[model samples]
Target: MNGPGPWGPAVDAQGAQDVLVHQALMYGSRHEYLLTAVPYLRAGRRAGDAVVVLVEPPVAAALRGQLGRETAAEIEFLDAAQWSRGPMHALASCHDRARADWWPRGRLRLLAEPVWRGRTPLETREWKRHDALLNVVFAGTPTMIMCAYDTAVLPGHVLDAAARTHPELAGPDGPAAAARYTAPAEFCAECDAGPLPPPPAVAARRSFATGGLPGLRSFLFTEAARLGLPEDRTLPFVLAVNEVATGIIRDGGGRGSLRVWAEAGELICDVADPVRVLADRFLGYEPPGAKGHDAAMWAVRRLCHIVETRSGPQGTQVRMRVRIG
Candidate 1:
């Protein structure tokens, strides 16, 4: 059932047992989502209930380590792409079996945005849909899907309050609370009212370097736009990378320098000035986007996961250590 009400799934936990499924796109960096899931996992352990975690491939190793042998053994980890690319019928059968065995597949929930079209400049209404679609597909049994990212922002105390206070479509004391949230009457009905207030801004301050010679050239161009290094100054560096390279010249205000060189297989970079990275610890900074931005922040975060977790094939390593002066 689709609704415009506060977006999220409902689990009835009045008297029976439960399993809370948390599908994470991020490895585990979102603190609020972890904040929400930790309590549920702990509560399940304390009460001898079940809790399962479904994570993407890059994060499985780290998660296995964090949860330890016993607890980790209880939580199941699977690849996120499996749900999207795998055979649907076989997946459904497997999910059903797991549910029968009291294990539910976790869903990666996306905060739903409204569809807009028609005008040259479209008008979009605000609609917030919080349903764990991914979790439901993977999880065969009755499930409670919660987003790790949102839960990170919301402390456990706050969610416990909402769970206790909000009118339960089905009371936690009831049988439906543990079931998937796809049932009728479990979703918001007033989407016409518009979306929830925009979520608080997340900080996303970081540089994107291509690595090696290509990386160096990209950095120099980026720097030139912001710092305006002299053409005479950049000419030699440009030629080193550019074959038919003429000197780089600037007509207006720019104040940055980019240098490129080779070191083994990895690219090393040093930026004199950066595009104002956020200083806050909890949130990364996001820059405003122009039309047809080559990549999305989602892609960047995925790349970040690769850089942070794996050393990669050929054992090449990329580092982004910040050296504060």
Candidate 2:
């Protein structure tokens, strides 16, 4: 197999160093997409690395048509829409796929396009955090990841944020170092600094303990329905809020507060506790298997449109949101 080529450094003479080639692909047209992604995939195949692509359905179809079914079959493909269900779920799945297919000493070549046009502001924020946390999550791993962003569809803010998250830029010409890249720690701190807008004036407030979980669930359902949350979304939203409340009772000092409100066509729930249960600054963004005991937060993330957490000397607060009809 050929050694590293255009995208990253060559394998060391002594042994392969754990390297991560994180790049952003800003493509303006279909031809640009083919030009930037195809060569990278070809290089990985030439180097005998496992290649995986996670992208939207349309892009996947286009890639398959361009690469041909037989050739595309050589690389793994996952739906970016599905992967975005939860940031942690997506990260966990990536690691799991890597371990299942290539672990220990195997090298990986992956392309991911997790954010797309029309993403809610809350989703945009969380996914950006997910992108920044990748550096820490995959530190010292022998992997090359290319995260694609469509310049024609995504807004400037999204593109600018993408530039900050990735350390390299891949184009038709080849890869180049990213000038705007911000280290993960600083990027995360910047994101965490801006908490979600305060929950709309609380329509209802309730205090609960472990024994009061059922009552909290019932309260959330009624308030959600009263606040005009879509019937279909109410249950999932309730479940998401329930998980956060449960986390508070189980880990956040045995008692907590829940506040429900409506804000600009969205249902918001704020849960706070006395104990600071989450120690990791990037807890919800990290994969569950890596941190353990994160299933509740993972579920909340998947079910809710937004999940925001803030911890300080006072305590920890979790705010979850879902669109209301």
Best by lDDT: 2
- Deviation from truth (RMSD, Å), model 2: 3.7
For model 1 the TM-score comes to: 0.29
Q: Per-residue alpha-carbon lDDT of model 1 for 136-156, expressed as tens digits?
A: 233333454443223334345
The C-alpha stretches of model 1 lying farther than 4 A from their native spots are 1-14, 17-29, 86-95, 103-142, 149-325
lDDT values of the candidates? Answer: 0.31, 0.78
Candidate 2: tens digits of C-alpha lDDT, residues 1-325: 1244675434555566576667889999888988878878777776667888998888888888877777798888888888876565677678777777764536788888885556666667778878887887776678888898889988898899989999878888777778999999788778778555665564589999979988888898889878898889999998887787777777678898878888877788888888765666765555467548466676677677667888887788888878776
Q: Count the backbone clashes (under 3 Å) in each candidate.
A: 36, 0
- Cα-based lDDT at residue 124, candidate 2: 76
Ten residues in a row with the worst lDDT in model 2? 1-10
